[model samples]
Target: MDAKEKPETTSSMPQRRPDCIKCFDALWFCYSPFHQMQNYYRYGEFDNCFGKWGDLVDCLALKTKRAAEAEEILIAREKAKPHIWTFRTVDEASENWWRMYKHLVLMSPPLPGAAQPPPRSDKS
Candidate 1:
């Protein structure tokens, strides 16, 4: 707290890159017919966020300007992108579903410390 001394500070947050695609998507949402229709119904006129279009344009330009670094990140993301795993056959999917159903419906026990669930009241 001395006049000539600097305050001690510490920060350990990870840096995150701003995503250009989010800006592009926001711009598209602003221009969608469904949104315009909703605006018309609510206010008796259509409205659009043209400023979001400028955000998208600026993002694209920045990406182009930093192509060298951006390209490296893009390459890493392309290589790391995950495809969902799937059951190859209908029978395989059905078998897995039945196994899960049986486990939950018949085999699993209540947690040791938990009270039994109340019986569900019929609504008719």
Candidate 2:
């Protein structure tokens, strides 16, 4: 390298987004209430059960937040697919709505540009 000359950079590696790896890894254990209930309540520790339930809810919320973020990326990648306007039946719509509600509970303000059902028009 000469004076007044910048050194050439070799790596053009793109920076990766910071994923909460530890959170994802620990979620497998944290979300399982079976172990906690078996070990704690079985030993007559009733108070711990309530606390454990709270902990589990928090963990689930964290997992959902991460999943919603990943879902956005997947949706973008699948944009080339034809977009359907309505559900074929009420049962299918209800099921999908329930799933979305659970997954996006912690996702504040909801996702932008999300698809909405067409407004119903009364012919009467």
Which candidate has the highest lDDT of all?
1
Q: Which ten residues in a row have the lowest lDDT in candidate 2?
A: 14-23
Error of 1 at 87 (Å): 55
Alpha-carbon deviation at 123 in model 1, angstroms: 63
Model 1, residue pairs in steric clash: none
Residue pairs in collision within model 2: none
Decoy 1 TM-score against native: 0.36
Candidate 1 Cα lDDT to native: 0.68
Q: For each predicted model, how many residue pairs clash, with residues at least 3 apart or on different chains?
A: 0, 0
What digit string (tens of lDDT, one per residue) describes model 1 on residues 1-124? 7888986545453333558989978878878999889989999987768789788876676566555576566567757977677435875665556656755644567677854433444743
**lDDT digits (tens) for residues 1-124 of candidate 2:** 6787987556574323324454454455544677657657667653344554554555455455665474565456568676687445885675567567755654556568965443444732
lDDT of each: 0.68, 0.55
